[model samples]
Target: MTTDILIEHRRDIADLKQRIKNRRLQVLGLFGTPIVLAVVLLVWAGLKISFWLHSDTPSAINNILGGVVAFLVLSVIVQLVAEFSEDFDVWRDRKTSVRELNLQLSLAEERHILEARRRTPPSMDRQASYKERLPGEIARLRYESQHYRRVHLLMQWLLFVSSSAISAVTAWYDPPQPAKGVLIGLGFTVTVITAAAGYFKPRERAFNLQQTADSIEQHATALELGIAPYNAMEEASNLELFATTVEGLRADQRMREQQLDQPQQGQQHVI
Candidate 1:
């Protein structure tokens, strides 16, 4: 009965990991195409705007205005897309968190089973079976968590670079008169600040991934010592630590959601 429960729990964890992996891939696919298109459009617009700004022809002003309008339209569209993508990422992360919580619950259950089985010394074959399988399960979870963290970090960096590029381009092509230039520079400064803030935002997934890795390392060490993990004093200590870490992550996630819900005061209209 205990073995069956353990197997079922392992399967549940495996399924959740697979779902998260697939969701990350889907997000990458959906946003990747649009980002590439946006970059291409931006580059084309930049070249055209540069040409128009440099020309001495009478129509240069009109051409420059048209290019600016086109760039603004495209920028707005890209910004909207980015907002949508961020919303999707939040939803996906919530789903991943729920799955992670479920996995942890399963691990707790498995620990209970191991505790029960430890009282009755198993045969060599049975002991060998667990020795072979437990490490693999722990390793797989660590790998999945690490991959998710990497993808998340990559997404943040991409947003930072893209937003900074957009702000720079806006400032370069539409250089304002002395008085207006100051206002434009201030606006650009705000955008740059926001982008930089995003890069430094607290990342719950990274924290959770690190906790998961630590848990796996503790489990592996316990297993190597021929210890029935759940019955080991150190193993129990590590599991409690893992639980505390996960709770901390959940609290941080709640705080972030609350911050997102609150409206910012005194921001100028971008349009």
Candidate 2:
């Protein structure tokens, strides 16, 4: 049975690996599309300005400047879209991985329970020992999840700051007339806000992921240590509880993926 369980786990892991790879490719495509579009638009805008450059009037120069600014703005929007798509893909992959890991652990635990039940009465204490190991496994998973979240958050913040600086420099170099400046400023402000929100949004998710992992670890530890409620439960009941916990985690993970995929109000592509 343990061998069978291990085989199943390996299959599941392989499936997850494939899924993640597919998602990554999809995300690359999503980001790539806007960059291609931006390049095309940029070329078109450049040609338009080149044609306008022949005229010597201030109005002609302003028209060229306006066209250039518009292209820049569109480029920023494309980049934001790409960023959002990448984030969504990453979040979904992480959530799915976590869910699958939890499920695997649960299945392993169930296998242990089954083996213990088949043992002679004198060997029941060995089952308890097996259970004791569960807490450590859970704790390790929680730590890993926390680290992943921290790294992801840091990357996002860096992207936001870099984008904002670029926008600021662009604004300064091309200081527009008062009216135009106001419009450009508004657009810049919107971009900054979106980036800021995107940077911070993952922190909450990180915390939640950590908390859930911790909870599972604690529950497993309690069960193993013959503590309180878990200690009182029969083998069947304990198995049921473990199954339920895994199911809940899976559901939560799916929900998170859906939420991450949902379009945000100010979502924009920056490419």
Candidate 3:
């Protein structure tokens, strides 16, 4: 664990933790999408009823149709978004079977590795060397992790602002019918986007990927520091152990990924 390696490890873990929190918030925000839309629809329904009670048949009918049209369009958008979002979750898994081969790296040796790495030239490419050799599975996992983290907040805000606009349109303002229709359409679009978020499960997937990545990093560090079984072993033996451990982690990650294809229970949330 040279200074560069330790620094890279800290950066990676910190990024993962922060991303996990953001993704979770996005998930919650997504679950809130439909709930918000439904509330808006209910309010519209009440408005329509009130109009009918006052003998305003045409206005009442138009209001009801506007709400219905918005709801349907929103549903379509939700499905489309959900379909794409599925590809973005960073699923991961782990295996305990490989524990037998792991060298129980001690704190002292770990410190020495960091000190040695720090003493090395600042230009050393330790992080690159490890990542350059990354297998396809790990590469895919990395892509998903980054993709979800970047998109989560964007999606959350998109839904929030879009839905809020619909709630803002009201009898109090007496917005023109055309303006009302557009607002309703916007509501539907945002609702669908939010609903799709609920369907895709990005938060769970990102978490799994982060966990698997962490495991790989820890094991690789153990080997780098010559700790435990990796410590006493020949270079050739250590490489073999390292290879098998990474493969095991990948296998577990793949297994966890299979669940994304399964049907998920419908969820509703309120902001």
Best by lDDT: 3
> Candidate 1 at residue 186, lDDT?
54
- Candidate 2 lDDT, 1-271, residue by residue in tens: 6556556756665666566565566556556756765776676567657775575536765576668667666765664554466545434443234456556556665765665456434435444444556556567657766876876666666656656665665667675566456556656765765665565566656666677777776667666676755665577566556556655774676566456545664333311
Candidate 2 TM-score, true structure as reference: 0.37
Model 1, residue 50: displacement in angstroms?
Answer: 47
Best of the two (1, 3) by lDDT = 3
lDDT of each: 0.56, 0.60, 0.63
For model 3, which pairs clash?
Answer: 1-113, 1-114, 2-117, 3-117, 3-118, 78-192, 90-205, 103-229, 226-231
Indicate the residue-level lDDT of 167 in model 3: 72
| TM-score winner, 1 or 3 | 3
- Candidate ranking (TM-score, best to worst): 3, 2, 1
Candidate 1 lDDT tens digits, 121-157: 3444444454456556556656766775676676567
TM-scores, one per candidate: 0.30, 0.37, 0.44
**Cα displacement (Å) at residue 200, model 3:** 1.9
Q: Rank the candidates by lDDT, best first.
A: 3, 2, 1
- Report the Cα lDDT for candidate 1: 0.56
The most accurate candidate by TM-score is 3
Which candidate do you rate higher for lDDT, 2 or 3?
3
Q: What RMSD does each model have against the real structure? A: 17.3, 16.3, 22.1
